[model samples]
Target: MPRLFTGLEISAQTGLMLSLLRGGLRGARWIDPENYHITLRFIGDVDDPTADEIADALARIRRDAVEIRVNGLGSFGNGKPHAVWARVEPNRALMELQGEQERILQRLRLPAERRKYIPHVTLARCRSATNQDVARWLSEHGGFQAPAFTAARFVLFSSRSSVGGGPYLVEEAYPLSVAGGLGDDFNADAFAGHDFG
Candidate 1:
């Protein structure tokens, strides 16, 4: 069995910027900068057959590369502040890709994701941090923003069954195309600037 999910990898430059927020707050277990990614669908522990089915199904999704921006900071767990994250600015392409992944998993008999999709790159896991601590951290770092980058691919990642901050391994990658495929929206201008030698 493998615990798997699909996500978009961030640029190292973006991850390095996010890494700067690691200290100051107590009880924060910072995720390694290399592990920073925006999760699309979390497909929990699955049999090898199911995993293969998921990998095959995902390869069929073809969307244009999405521009991702980390525009702000936030946390979950209400008063307890269990986690902090660098929020991803949501746009149509990103939402569609995530929704496609969710639908694929559900069609394979995986449970539907109950939470509304909120795209974010988790920064830290809060262990003993209180509401005040998280609030203070957010106040100081709330204006943080990373230079936007276009994601060329989404990946299937495997992880050990443990706490969320991961030592994830990429199992497979699927590229997004500028040239329209199947149901993808066509952009004729995508070819305009290219030098086809």
Candidate 2:
């Protein structure tokens, strides 16, 4: 069985931009730039045939590409720390996509997700952090927001571990045609968070 999930591949350019953000955090275990993505659903480990079925189901998804603005910065823990992530601004388009994908996965008979949907891109994993450190980091990086970018397609990815990192790979892409074809990948250099003025 292979680990599987659906995600939006952050283009090479976006990956670079995200990498730069990670550079600021001294304690951050910066995720490899190549593995950066916005995951829609995690399908866990499954057989090849189920993976194919998942791809087929996802290809039937009919929705145009959406505009996603990456904004805000936050960590996900209190007391004993766990992880840190970049949060996305909530909007109808994002909510709809999340709900739609959730429903699709449920129809496939997967277990119901325990938590409510909150869209975000995980940036770093924190083993632990002191109260003072967390406060300082938040204050220094407050108001962190990435410029809006378009999400053109949803992908079914096969994740596996390697020496560099473990369990993240793209297997197939199911595009959502909006206007013409998918929009070009946003340039990281253009949106590089420099000065943030």
Candidate 3:
């Protein structure tokens, strides 16, 4: 069984920019630059049959390529602060693409997602980092922004189910160039502290 999901791949240049914010904050395990992505939907471990059906359904989406803007920085746990991420500014195209994925998956009988979708590219997982620690870190790096990029494609990725950063594999890719199409990936509840798998 594979742990699968869909996501938008971040450019290496953007990843390098995001990587610069790695240290200083104590107890943060930064994700590798290669794993940097904006997840569109998390499809948990599923039977091969369901996976194929999902691929087929997703490939049918038609929407325009989304213009991604990494505007700022934020943390998930609020006062508790479990994770930190680069915010993906949500717009109509991005929101609709994600919403379409949500509907398609629910139609596949996957349980409806319980959390409101918040678009973000996870930067690090917080471990024992204090409220003050996070606050200070946010103050220092909150102005983080990457050059806006056009997402021409979205992909279905598979990952090993394990703790500690990712080595997520791309299983299927769905291009977002059909005049109109959906995006690639997103997470469970962002505040829920999920990795990019």
Separately for all candidates shown, the number of backbone clashes (residues 3 or more apart, or on different chains) is 0, 3, 14
Better of 1 and 3 by TM-score: 1
Best by TM-score: 1
Whole-structure CA lDDT of model 2: 0.68
TM-score of each: 0.89, 0.83, 0.88
* Candidate 2 lowest-lDDT run of ten: 188-197
Per-residue lDDT of candidate 3, residues 1-197 (tens digit): 67788888887678889999999999988898899999988888887778878888888998778888998999999568899999999999889999999999999999888888899999899998998998999999989989887787777888888854588877776667634343333322221212233
* Reference-based TM-score, model 2: 0.83
Decide which is better by TM-score, 2 or 3: 3
- Greater TM-score among 1 and 2 belongs to 1
lDDT (0 to 1) per candidate: 0.84, 0.68, 0.82
> Where does model 1 exceed 4 Å of error?
179-197
Tell me how far the alpha carbon of residue 23 in candidate 3 is from the true structure, in angstroms, after superposition.
0.5
Can you tell me which runs of candidate 2 are displaced by over 4 Å? 11-13, 24-27, 161-167, 186-197
Candidate 1 has a TM-score of 0.89
